[model samples]
Target: MTVIAQLSDIHVRPHGVLYQDAVDSNAMFSAAVDSLNSNRPEPDLVVISGDLTDEGTVDEYQKLRELLARLRQPFVVMPGNHDNRGNLRAAFPDHPWLPGEGSLSFARDVGQLRLVALDTSVPGLHHGELDAASLAWLDDELTVHRDQTVVIFMHHPPFMTGIPYLDIYGLRNADALAMVLARHKNVDRILAGHVHRSMQTRLGNVPVLTCPSTTTQIALRVEADAQPASFLEPPAYMLHRWTGRGQPAVSHLCYVGRFEGPLPFA
Candidate 1:
């Protein structure tokens, strides 16, 4: 079995700074890291989907790099709408998978599972979209990896989440992405992180899910006129356990922070 730990929307702040002059995102991320280190069924890979920084700044990335050095597991990162591709690439010069130019997308194998990371971030915009080249790349990858269970991870989900404010900045060319995905059936699931809350949906006939942020969670409001807001929800992440080909992968939500004892059942 292979276990992949997914942490999303870190929004790391600049050194000695608090995110938005309010939440201490850096501390929250550190706590999350500690939680992962002590977690059972130690993960083989850690995937940080996006929103790596509150602002796409050099200082932020530098601070983020410093924080990530404490993580014990091997990990991969992709950009989100809040990230600057060039800065991100420069900060992680060791991650050769990130392309020298254009979107940061790559397909790599972890154990028996094929992990395909798509770059859905749009420059200078909060809404996400995939260009023609990226779509072509995805289609080609899916075609070549048909025999393996492929799990697509990106910063933005390809479906409307029904949250009024969030949907306003949702993926713009979702139809185009869906079209490309419809051509391939090897995709076991699509994972994302922009929503800052756990959500589930479907695209291209495959299951899609969003991971909760390690900092805050977006309020779950489906009303059409709901306002955009965030809350101090408990920091959390997902542990995706893949047993093998014949069996479906299971995802468990794990919360960060100390809690009361796990007493025996009465």
Candidate 2:
């Protein structure tokens, strides 16, 4: 069995940079880190689906790198819409998702899983696109690895969830992505971050998993007919497991920090 943990939307500090969330990202991220390190049956690999930093600053990335360096397992990090490609590249020089870079993919023949990181961030913007070039590259890569089981990791999701405010910021060139996905049958699951919600759905016959954030939730419910978002809930993270012929895969969703109460369950 191959174990993969998926952590999304880590809004690491150097706060006040994003000006929106105002949440202390480093603290929130640490809660997740502590939980993962102390959990039973540690994961084999970790995948962070972007939003590593709030304002995408070098200092923020520096702090994030230092924190992630504490993990007991190997991990791959990607960039989300709020991430700055240049800062991320320099912070993690060997990182694969750098702009204009060839590709950042890891192949584990032993586990029969090929982990692919797709760069979906649009520079100087808060949306995602699979651009013609990226789509072409993905198509070619899938064709070559037709026999290999694939799990794609990206920052943005291709489908809309009717969350209204969040839905407006979903992927743009989704049709292009959908067309490419249809041609490949080896893809097991398409995972993403950005939305900061634990949203699950199917796209092109494959499951799309969006891991929640470590800072705060965008409030799945509308406060009023007009209000859009709220931070009234605790932060959270996810773990994804893959079970093969010999190994089994399991994914877990964990909430960080303490909440109100147990509510006296029956």
Candidate 3:
């Protein structure tokens, strides 16, 4: 089995800075890094879905670089609405898996699993949309890696989360994404972030799982016209265990914290 760990919306800031001038997101993110490092069975790869920096500034990326140095597993990152693609690329010059220009998207193979990352972030926009170039890249990658089990990861989810306020910021061209996804049957799952909450839904038969942030979470207020809000809910991440080809990948939502556990099951 191939194990993939995912952390999203870290929202790291420069030293001595807090997210929204309140929550100490950097500290919280550090805790999450610790949690992943000590995770049992040890994940084979780590994918940070997006929102790596709160302001996408050089200092914030530098801080992120310092924080990521503590992680023991290999990692890759994508961009969200809050991220600056150019800055992110500059932050990690050694990550050749990432392209040097245009839409930070790429595909990699982890054992037999084909991991595809899609760039859905639009510059200077809060909502996301998959452009023709990105969609075409995904289609071609999926076409080339037809025999392997595939999982597509992106910043925005293709399905609505039922929260009106957050839904407004959801992927703008989900129908177009569905069209590309519908053609590929080898795609076992689709992973995404940007909602800052854990959600599950399907887009054209393929299951999509959104990872919770490493810091705060979005309040689950589904009432009509509910305003946008955040909560100090427990930070969390996801672990996807891909068993093999033609089988469903099992996912686990792991909360970051120290708690009583490993007790007798009597």
How close is every model to the real structure, measured as TM-score? 0.97, 0.87, 0.98
228: Cα error in model 2, Å: 3.1
Least well predicted 10-residue stretch by lDDT in candidate 2: 101-110
What is the TM-score (0 to 1) of candidate 1? Answer: 0.97
Worst 10 residues of 3 by lDDT: 241-250
Count residue pairs with overlapping backbones in model 1: 0
Against the reference, the lDDT scores of all candidates come to 0.92, 0.77, 0.92
Which residue runs of candidate 1 sit more than 4 Å off their true CA positions? none
Stretches of model 2 off by over 4 angstroms after superposition: 15-22, 94-110, 221-226, 246-249, 258-266
* Residue range 71-167, candidate 2, lDDT tens digits: 8877777888777877777888765444455333333332678777888878888878877778888888788989877888888898886777776
Q: What is the C-alpha local distance difference test score of candidate 3?
A: 0.92
Q: For residues 1-266, what per-residue lDDT tens digits would candidate 1 score against the true structure? A: 98999999999999888877889999999999999999776899999999999899999999999999999998999999999999999999999888999899988999899999999999999999999999999989988888888999999988888898998888899899889888887788899999999988888688898999999899989988888889999999999998995576899999999998788875
Clashing pairs in 1: none
- Cα displacement (angstroms), candidate 3, residue 106, comes to 0.6
lDDT (C-alpha) at residue 5 in model 2? 81
Candidate 3 versus the native: TM-score? 0.98
